[model samples]
Target: MLEKLRKLANILYWAATAVLIALPIAALGYLLAETPNPNRASALFPHIDIIASPTGLAFWSAFSAGALSFLLFIGFLWSLRGLFDFYRKGQILTLHAAGAILRLGKWLIALALVRFMTLPTQTLLLTSNNPDGHRQLAISISDHEVGFLLAAGLLTLIGWAMNEAVRISDENKAFV
Candidate 1:
Protein backbone atom coordinates (compact mmCIF):
# COMPACT_ATOMS: atom_id res chain seq x y z
CA MET A 1 0.00 0.00 0.00
CA LEU A 2 2.74 2.38 0.97
CA GLU A 3 4.72 1.57 -2.15
CA LYS A 4 1.68 2.34 -4.25
CA LEU A 5 1.19 5.61 -2.50
CA ARG A 6 4.85 6.54 -3.04
CA LYS A 7 4.58 5.78 -6.72
CA LEU A 8 1.46 7.91 -6.99
CA ALA A 9 3.20 10.79 -5.28
CA ASN A 10 6.17 10.52 -7.61
CA ILE A 11 3.94 10.52 -10.65
CA LEU A 12 2.01 13.52 -9.46
CA TYR A 13 5.21 15.43 -8.76
CA TRP A 14 6.64 14.73 -12.19
CA ALA A 15 3.40 15.66 -13.89
CA ALA A 16 3.29 18.95 -12.04
CA THR A 17 6.91 19.65 -12.91
CA ALA A 18 6.34 18.93 -16.57
CA VAL A 19 3.37 21.25 -16.72
CA LEU A 20 5.28 24.01 -14.94
CA ILE A 21 8.25 23.62 -17.29
CA ALA A 22 6.06 23.58 -20.36
CA LEU A 23 4.43 26.89 -19.52
CA PRO A 24 7.70 28.82 -19.62
CA ILE A 25 9.03 27.04 -22.68
CA ALA A 26 5.87 27.68 -24.62
CA ALA A 27 5.96 31.35 -23.69
CA LEU A 28 9.61 31.59 -24.63
CA GLY A 29 8.98 30.00 -27.98
CA TYR A 30 6.16 32.41 -28.69
CA LEU A 31 8.35 35.36 -27.80
CA LEU A 32 11.11 34.15 -30.09
CA ALA A 33 8.72 33.73 -32.99
CA GLU A 34 6.76 36.95 -32.60
CA THR A 35 8.02 40.50 -32.38
CA PRO A 36 6.69 42.02 -29.17
CA ASN A 37 5.28 45.52 -28.92
CA PRO A 38 7.83 47.69 -27.13
CA ASN A 39 5.16 49.94 -25.65
CA ARG A 40 2.91 47.19 -24.31
CA ALA A 41 3.11 44.71 -21.44
CA SER A 42 3.41 41.04 -22.24
CA ALA A 43 0.80 38.57 -21.11
CA LEU A 44 3.50 36.81 -19.15
CA PHE A 45 5.01 39.70 -17.30
CA PRO A 46 8.76 39.98 -16.58
CA HIS A 47 9.65 37.07 -18.84
CA ILE A 48 8.84 38.11 -22.38
CA ASP A 49 7.62 41.22 -24.13
CA ILE A 50 4.77 40.99 -26.61
CA ILE A 51 6.25 43.46 -29.12
CA ALA A 52 9.95 43.75 -28.33
CA SER A 53 12.64 42.17 -30.49
CA PRO A 54 13.94 39.01 -28.91
CA THR A 55 17.59 39.83 -28.50
CA GLY A 56 20.26 37.15 -28.29
CA LEU A 57 21.16 38.23 -24.79
CA ALA A 58 17.57 38.08 -23.57
CA PHE A 59 17.08 34.69 -25.17
CA TRP A 60 20.18 33.23 -23.57
CA SER A 61 19.43 34.75 -20.21
CA ALA A 62 15.90 33.40 -20.20
CA PHE A 63 17.16 30.02 -21.31
CA SER A 64 19.72 29.85 -18.57
CA ALA A 65 17.31 31.03 -15.92
CA GLY A 66 14.70 28.56 -17.08
CA ALA A 67 17.24 25.76 -17.05
CA LEU A 68 18.34 26.59 -13.53
CA SER A 69 14.76 26.83 -12.31
CA PHE A 70 13.95 23.50 -13.91
CA LEU A 71 16.91 21.90 -12.19
CA LEU A 72 15.86 23.30 -8.83
CA PHE A 73 12.32 22.11 -9.38
CA ILE A 74 13.63 18.64 -10.16
CA GLY A 75 15.68 18.65 -7.01
CA PHE A 76 12.67 19.56 -4.96
CA LEU A 77 10.66 16.83 -6.57
CA TRP A 78 13.33 14.22 -5.90
CA SER A 79 13.61 15.26 -2.29
CA LEU A 80 9.87 15.01 -1.98
CA ARG A 81 10.04 11.50 -3.44
CA GLY A 82 12.62 10.50 -0.91
CA LEU A 83 10.61 11.96 1.92
CA PHE A 84 7.55 10.10 0.77
CA ASP A 85 9.45 6.85 0.52
CA PHE A 86 10.69 7.26 4.02
CA TYR A 87 7.20 7.89 5.27
CA ARG A 88 5.75 4.93 3.44
CA LYS A 89 8.37 2.64 4.92
CA GLY A 90 7.55 3.86 8.40
CA GLN A 91 11.07 5.27 8.69
CA ILE A 92 9.69 8.73 9.20
CA LEU A 93 8.79 7.69 12.73
CA THR A 94 12.47 7.35 13.59
CA LEU A 95 14.80 10.09 14.83
CA HIS A 96 17.50 9.50 12.23
CA ALA A 97 15.01 9.74 9.40
CA ALA A 98 13.42 12.76 10.98
CA GLY A 99 16.70 14.66 10.96
CA ALA A 100 17.31 13.82 7.32
CA ILE A 101 13.77 14.83 6.44
CA LEU A 102 14.22 18.15 8.26
CA ARG A 103 17.37 18.86 6.29
CA LEU A 104 15.64 18.14 3.02
CA GLY A 105 12.71 20.26 4.12
CA LYS A 106 15.04 23.13 4.87
CA TRP A 107 16.57 22.94 1.41
CA LEU A 108 13.14 22.95 -0.16
CA ILE A 109 12.15 25.94 1.93
CA ALA A 110 15.28 27.78 0.85
CA LEU A 111 14.52 27.11 -2.78
CA ALA A 112 11.03 28.50 -2.34
CA LEU A 113 12.48 31.60 -0.67
CA VAL A 114 14.94 32.16 -3.50
CA ARG A 115 12.13 31.85 -5.99
CA PHE A 116 9.98 34.33 -4.09
CA MET A 117 12.81 36.83 -3.80
CA THR A 118 13.57 36.81 -7.54
CA LEU A 119 9.94 37.32 -8.57
CA PRO A 120 9.78 40.99 -7.63
CA THR A 121 12.92 42.01 -9.45
CA GLN A 122 11.82 39.97 -12.42
CA THR A 123 8.40 41.62 -12.41
CA LEU A 124 9.84 45.11 -12.07
CA LEU A 125 12.24 44.58 -14.92
CA LEU A 126 9.50 43.14 -17.07
CA THR A 127 6.80 45.74 -16.44
CA SER A 128 8.32 48.96 -15.15
CA ASN A 129 8.49 52.02 -17.40
CA ASN A 130 10.88 54.90 -16.93
CA PRO A 131 8.00 57.40 -16.90
CA ASP A 132 4.45 56.22 -16.44
CA GLY A 133 1.54 55.50 -14.08
CA HIS A 134 2.01 51.81 -14.83
CA ARG A 135 5.00 51.54 -12.51
CA GLN A 136 2.78 51.59 -9.44
CA LEU A 137 0.50 48.97 -10.91
CA ALA A 138 3.48 46.84 -11.78
CA ILE A 139 4.74 47.08 -8.23
CA SER A 140 1.32 46.20 -6.93
CA ILE A 141 1.12 43.13 -9.10
CA SER A 142 4.60 42.12 -8.02
CA ASP A 143 3.52 42.40 -4.42
CA HIS A 144 0.59 40.09 -5.11
CA GLU A 145 2.88 37.52 -6.67
CA VAL A 146 5.21 37.76 -3.71
CA GLY A 147 2.31 37.30 -1.36
CA PHE A 148 1.11 34.19 -3.14
CA LEU A 149 4.61 32.70 -3.17
CA LEU A 150 5.03 33.38 0.54
CA ALA A 151 1.70 31.78 1.31
CA ALA A 152 2.59 28.70 -0.66
CA GLY A 153 5.96 28.53 1.05
CA LEU A 154 4.33 28.76 4.43
CA LEU A 155 1.97 25.92 3.61
CA THR A 156 4.87 23.75 2.48
CA LEU A 157 6.74 24.51 5.70
CA ILE A 158 3.73 23.55 7.74
CA GLY A 159 3.49 20.22 5.96
CA TRP A 160 7.18 19.59 6.58
CA ALA A 161 6.79 20.37 10.26
CA MET A 162 3.91 17.98 10.51
CA ASN A 163 6.01 15.25 8.96
CA GLU A 164 8.78 16.02 11.40
CA ALA A 165 6.41 15.67 14.31
CA VAL A 166 5.19 12.31 13.06
CA ARG A 167 8.78 11.11 12.76
CA ILE A 168 9.60 12.23 16.27
CA SER A 169 6.55 10.53 17.68
CA ASP A 170 7.47 7.29 16.01
CA GLU A 171 10.97 7.49 17.39
CA ASN A 172 9.68 8.06 20.87
CA LYS A 173 7.44 5.03 20.61
CA ALA A 174 10.38 2.82 19.58
CA PHE A 175 12.43 4.08 22.51
CA VAL A 176 9.62 3.39 24.95
Candidate 2:
Protein backbone atom coordinates (compact mmCIF):
# COMPACT_ATOMS: atom_id res chain seq x y z
CA MET A 1 0.00 0.00 0.00
CA LEU A 2 2.76 2.39 0.96
CA GLU A 3 4.68 1.56 -2.21
CA LYS A 4 1.63 2.22 -4.32
CA LEU A 5 1.06 5.53 -2.64
CA ARG A 6 4.64 6.54 -3.26
CA LYS A 7 4.39 5.59 -6.92
CA LEU A 8 1.15 7.50 -7.32
CA ALA A 9 2.65 10.55 -5.69
CA ASN A 10 5.65 10.37 -7.96
CA ILE A 11 3.44 10.23 -11.01
CA LEU A 12 1.33 13.11 -9.76
CA TYR A 13 4.39 15.17 -8.96
CA TRP A 14 5.67 14.79 -12.48
CA ALA A 15 2.26 15.49 -13.96
CA ALA A 16 1.87 18.66 -11.93
CA THR A 17 5.38 19.79 -12.80
CA ALA A 18 4.61 19.36 -16.46
CA VAL A 19 1.43 21.38 -16.09
CA LEU A 20 3.28 24.09 -14.18
CA ILE A 21 5.59 24.45 -17.11
CA ALA A 22 3.02 24.04 -19.84
CA LEU A 23 0.32 26.34 -18.48
CA PRO A 24 2.40 29.49 -18.79
CA ILE A 25 3.37 28.61 -22.31
CA ALA A 26 -0.29 28.13 -23.12
CA ALA A 27 -1.26 31.38 -21.39
CA LEU A 28 1.38 33.22 -23.34
CA GLY A 29 -0.01 31.72 -26.45
CA TYR A 30 -3.42 33.07 -25.55
CA LEU A 31 -1.99 36.49 -24.83
CA LEU A 32 -0.25 36.54 -28.18
CA ALA A 33 -3.06 35.07 -30.17
CA GLU A 34 -6.57 34.61 -28.75
CA THR A 35 -6.58 37.32 -26.09
CA PRO A 36 -9.29 39.93 -26.49
CA ASN A 37 -8.94 43.65 -25.81
CA PRO A 38 -7.48 44.69 -22.43
CA ASN A 39 -9.77 47.54 -21.37
CA ARG A 40 -12.06 45.26 -19.37
CA ALA A 41 -12.28 41.49 -18.88
CA SER A 42 -15.31 39.34 -18.19
CA ALA A 43 -14.24 35.95 -16.94
CA LEU A 44 -17.34 34.11 -15.75
CA PHE A 45 -14.19 32.25 -14.82
CA PRO A 46 -14.43 28.92 -13.00
CA HIS A 47 -17.30 28.35 -15.44
CA ILE A 48 -16.38 29.93 -18.76
CA ASP A 49 -13.64 31.63 -20.77
CA ILE A 50 -12.81 35.27 -20.21
CA ILE A 51 -14.13 38.03 -22.47
CA ALA A 52 -11.82 41.01 -22.88
CA SER A 53 -12.82 44.33 -24.41
CA PRO A 54 -10.26 46.82 -25.69
CA THR A 55 -12.35 49.96 -25.24
CA GLY A 56 -11.91 51.27 -21.73
CA LEU A 57 -9.51 52.81 -19.20
CA ALA A 58 -9.59 49.44 -17.50
CA PHE A 59 -7.69 47.84 -20.35
CA TRP A 60 -4.15 48.19 -19.09
CA SER A 61 -5.28 47.76 -15.52
CA ALA A 62 -7.08 44.56 -16.37
CA PHE A 63 -4.13 43.28 -18.35
CA SER A 64 -1.66 43.94 -15.57
CA ALA A 65 -3.98 42.50 -12.97
CA GLY A 66 -4.42 39.36 -15.01
CA ALA A 67 -0.66 38.96 -15.28
CA LEU A 68 -0.22 39.32 -11.55
CA SER A 69 -3.02 36.87 -10.89
CA PHE A 70 -1.46 34.39 -13.27
CA LEU A 71 1.74 34.60 -11.25
CA LEU A 72 -0.18 33.74 -8.09
CA PHE A 73 -1.85 30.87 -9.90
CA ILE A 74 1.56 29.57 -10.85
CA GLY A 75 2.70 29.88 -7.26
CA PHE A 76 -0.25 27.77 -6.20
CA LEU A 77 0.85 25.02 -8.55
CA TRP A 78 4.43 25.28 -7.34
CA SER A 79 3.27 24.76 -3.77
CA LEU A 80 1.29 21.76 -4.86
CA ARG A 81 4.44 20.41 -6.42
CA GLY A 82 6.16 20.71 -3.07
CA LEU A 83 3.39 18.77 -1.40
CA PHE A 84 3.62 16.05 -4.00
CA ASP A 85 7.39 15.88 -3.69
CA PHE A 86 7.12 15.25 0.04
CA TYR A 87 4.42 12.65 -0.43
CA ARG A 88 6.45 10.85 -3.05
CA LYS A 89 9.15 10.37 -0.44
CA GLY A 90 6.63 9.16 2.16
CA GLN A 91 6.93 12.36 4.16
CA ILE A 92 3.30 13.43 4.06
CA LEU A 93 3.18 14.66 7.64
CA THR A 94 6.44 16.59 7.59
CA LEU A 95 7.04 20.30 7.99
CA HIS A 96 7.49 20.64 4.22
CA ALA A 97 4.04 19.26 3.54
CA ALA A 98 2.52 21.53 6.15
CA GLY A 99 4.22 24.55 4.67
CA ALA A 100 3.09 23.64 1.19
CA ILE A 101 -0.49 23.24 2.32
CA LEU A 102 -0.40 26.54 4.14
CA ARG A 103 0.90 28.18 1.02
CA LEU A 104 -1.97 26.68 -0.93
CA GLY A 105 -4.40 28.44 1.40
CA LYS A 106 -2.71 31.76 0.85
CA TRP A 107 -2.78 31.31 -2.89
CA LEU A 108 -6.43 30.39 -2.81
CA ILE A 109 -7.31 33.56 -0.93
CA ALA A 110 -5.34 35.64 -3.37
CA LEU A 111 -7.00 33.92 -6.28
CA ALA A 112 -10.41 34.80 -4.90
CA LEU A 113 -9.43 38.43 -4.69
CA VAL A 114 -8.21 38.33 -8.26
CA ARG A 115 -11.48 36.83 -9.34
CA PHE A 116 -13.39 39.58 -7.60
CA MET A 117 -11.45 42.22 -9.45
CA THR A 118 -11.71 40.58 -12.84
CA LEU A 119 -15.26 39.25 -12.81
CA PRO A 120 -17.01 42.61 -13.07
CA THR A 121 -14.59 43.81 -15.67
CA GLN A 122 -15.22 40.68 -17.73
CA THR A 123 -18.91 41.50 -18.07
CA LEU A 124 -18.15 44.74 -19.80
CA LEU A 125 -15.49 43.17 -21.94
CA LEU A 126 -17.81 40.50 -23.16
CA THR A 127 -20.25 43.05 -24.52
CA SER A 128 -17.88 45.76 -25.66
CA ASN A 129 -16.97 44.02 -28.88
CA ASN A 130 -20.50 43.62 -30.15
CA PRO A 131 -20.81 45.82 -33.23
CA ASP A 132 -24.49 46.68 -32.91
CA GLY A 133 -25.86 45.48 -29.58
CA HIS A 134 -25.60 47.83 -26.62
CA ARG A 135 -22.68 46.92 -24.35
CA GLN A 136 -23.81 45.22 -21.16
CA LEU A 137 -22.28 45.47 -17.72
CA ALA A 138 -22.67 42.51 -15.38
CA ILE A 139 -20.75 40.88 -12.54
CA SER A 140 -21.25 37.98 -10.17
CA ILE A 141 -19.15 35.51 -8.21
CA SER A 142 -19.52 31.88 -9.07
CA ASP A 143 -20.25 29.06 -6.61
CA HIS A 144 -17.02 27.42 -7.72
CA GLU A 145 -14.86 30.25 -6.39
CA VAL A 146 -16.61 30.17 -3.06
CA GLY A 147 -16.17 26.44 -2.87
CA PHE A 148 -12.47 26.76 -3.65
CA LEU A 149 -12.01 29.22 -0.81
CA LEU A 150 -13.76 26.90 1.60
CA ALA A 151 -11.57 24.00 0.57
CA ALA A 152 -8.50 26.15 1.00
CA GLY A 153 -9.46 27.04 4.54
CA LEU A 154 -10.00 23.38 5.31
CA LEU A 155 -6.60 22.41 3.94
CA THR A 156 -4.94 25.11 6.01
CA LEU A 157 -6.53 23.84 9.20
CA ILE A 158 -5.61 20.26 8.39
CA GLY A 159 -2.01 21.16 7.64
CA TRP A 160 -1.65 23.15 10.84
CA ALA A 161 -2.98 20.27 12.90
CA MET A 162 -0.73 17.83 11.07
CA ASN A 163 2.31 19.96 11.86
CA GLU A 164 1.42 20.15 15.53
CA ALA A 165 0.94 16.41 15.69
CA VAL A 166 4.34 15.83 14.13
CA ARG A 167 5.91 18.18 16.64
CA ILE A 168 4.32 16.34 19.55
CA SER A 169 5.47 12.98 18.22
CA ASP A 170 9.02 14.23 17.87
CA GLU A 171 9.03 15.50 21.43
CA ASN A 172 7.72 12.18 22.73
CA LYS A 173 10.43 10.33 20.80
CA ALA A 174 13.06 12.58 22.36
CA PHE A 175 12.11 11.33 25.86
CA VAL A 176 12.30 7.70 24.70
- Clash count of each predicted structure: 5, 5
Candidate 2 C-alpha RMSD relative to the actual structure: 4.5
Which runs of model 1 end up more than 4 angstroms from their true locations?
1-47, 100-104, 117-176
- For model 1, residues 26-119, the per-residue Cα lDDT tens digits are 8679878864543334543444332443344443443444456556766665665566556556554555445546555565666656565454
What TM-score number comes out for model 2? 0.77
lDDT of 2 by residue, 1-176 (tens): 88898999999999999999899999888777755544324431323243434455545554565677789889989988888899999987677788778888878888877877775665465455555555556677689878987887888787788778888888988999
Which residue runs of candidate 2 sit more than 4 Å off their true CA positions? 34-57, 121-137
Evaluate model 1: give its TM-score: 0.47
Using lDDT as the measure, which candidate wins?
2
lDDT of each: 0.55, 0.73
Pairs that clash in candidate 2: 38-59, 39-59, 41-121, 41-122, 42-122
Model 1's alpha-carbon lDDT is 0.55
